[model samples]
Target: MAATKVLVVDDSLTMRALISGALERIPNVEVVGLADGAEEARALVERLRPDVMTLDVEMPGISGLQYLAELMEVRPMPVIMFSTRTAAGAQDTVEALRLGAIECFPKPKVAVPAELEKIIAKLGRCIKAAKGATLRKAASPASHAILPQIEWNGRVLAIGGDAASTKTIFDLLGSFPANCPPTIVVQHLNEDVAAAMVGKLDMKVAARVVMAEDGMAIEQGSIYYAPPGEAHLVVDGSVPPRLRLLSRDPVAGARPSISVLFASLARSVGADTVGLRLNEGDDGTSGLDAMATSDGYCIKPNPAGGFELSKKTMTQAIIEPELARMVLKLCSR
Candidate 1:
């Protein structure tokens, strides 16, 4: 196989040389260019076109976070952030991940090059994993956690979520009524665990659920789901439009980005749209707030609910089916 081309971006010449040396030792991995900072990275990205980039969290003009966001918007590439092991650095690294970096590397002030070499090995694996991973998609309207009553009235209800947001959808759709709204979800799930999640959810809810298709119609009792791996999904203007797929990269570390759906729903259903999210990270916080503030009746998971995942607690203290019925009743009123 041809050598995997690499780019090392850092303001520190020592740091760049160390990273380059580590990569050089690795078989089939080639360091193509050394960028002084984000500006250089941008220019070199156009010229060298490296397979992967090792980005520093802090730089001269534009920070790594800012650079990554700009890079993703224009010519997208896989970026692994090399960050300091400080608390502030951790926060920025998380922000980088949310902004679409593959992963982060914590650069500690260590004694030997061997210590840094270990970090390089880990970085390489992360790059390889990201290149093969799938992205999240927009959840179907039917997958709304706080789904509407299965009235099958006139329009369809769609829902979508990513890794940090799908659990909120599950909470919002608990004990859903089969007769309620026709729903769909484009949840971002891993391959090994993806198949199991639909059933774990289906057994608790009333709707007969199935994976989604591009041409499926909006029905009264059934909801469909699309397994979004790495492409973004959107709905076109149709008599209940079909799910359209795109080769675009991720948004806020999400494939079926909530922003994409919320924007689409605002265009499609207008005031009829309702949205919700449980803030797991900054990505969730921003997305939920934007959607709610926009003329849609949006709900957020109450942090007061103490619904922490690691704590083995659920924040959805109330059943969503009842909430859905309540929402429907209010809409009729």
Candidate 2:
């Protein structure tokens, strides 16, 4: 197979070299070109036509975020952002991801040799995964109207995803009504990114979004995000389901494993549970299978566009708004 071509864009010369050097060390990756700012980056993009790009979140003239927006409009392609882990940087990184960047990695602070190796290793894996990502312009949040309130049926909605599912999750939850079902989400993220995402979702979406806490009641109309760390979030099969933060080893390489959450929902809610898998990898397949075997409904991306159920019996693909409507109908019934 041909190497994955990459373009490195950053204002600092040292950073450009550092990133390019690290990428060159990885097998099956080629640094096609390096640019200092958006203008140079734009010209290089037209000339080099790289498969993926690594962009610094902040730049001198046209910011990385601004360039990303323009690029998505004209020629969409996979992009990964590099930013500091500061509070302000985290907010901007979240915005970048929402704008269609494949992933975001924090820039090295001290440039310590050991730490740089670790970060580069993770970035290499991200770059590899990004080559297969499907890129498209992000839809305006205003375009999706909030769904109408549905009758309460004691059902729960569970969502699981990875880095590629950021925008989808935002759009999906944004369309939900203010009093939608009690929803739980498990997205593979670091603590900083997870906190920023929760904050953004709480402010933008109609439903309340909060990080899950041990023994928290799974209430209606609220969305709980499983915090990333040593513990996995699971649902207790009680009279009224409650969230539990269980300290366990990472499952399928994710501490907040989607499989653990889905399996718990399958046991607790049975058919009352609705599971949506967005851009998730193989780790969640078993959990989704468990949900389906227990008679719970499962939805996954259809590849042609929109989403379809995991069951082969239903093959019709439905768009995001229709998905929200279907979830409402299913839970109400």
- 145 in model 1: Cα distance from truth in Å? 15
Give the Cα error of residue 221 in candidate 2, in Å.
0.7
List TM-score per model, in order: 0.46, 0.95
Residues 1-333, candidate 2: write the lDDT tens digits.
Answer: 889999999998888888898899999999999999999999999999999999999898899999999988899999999998899898988888888998998888865445568777778888888886667788775666898888878788899997778888888888888888999999988888899999999988998999999999898889999999989999998877899999999888888999999999999888888888886576677888888888888988877778886543554567865887887777774
lDDT of 1 by residue, 1-333 (tens): 677788999888888888888878877788999998887788888898888888998887888877877877676677777877666665565456555666677775874587786566756665554443322322333445544454444444555554334434554555366675566565554432344556555665667776656556656567666555765655556766556666677778777565665556556655555554434333344544444454555554444442221111222343433445533542342
Task: Give each prediction's root-mean-square deviation over alpha carbons.
Answer: 16.8, 1.7
Judged by lDDT against the true structure, how good is candidate 2?
A: 0.87
Clashing pairs in 2: none
Q: Who wins the TM-score comparison?
A: 2
**What lDDT does the true structure give each of the candidates?**
0.60, 0.87
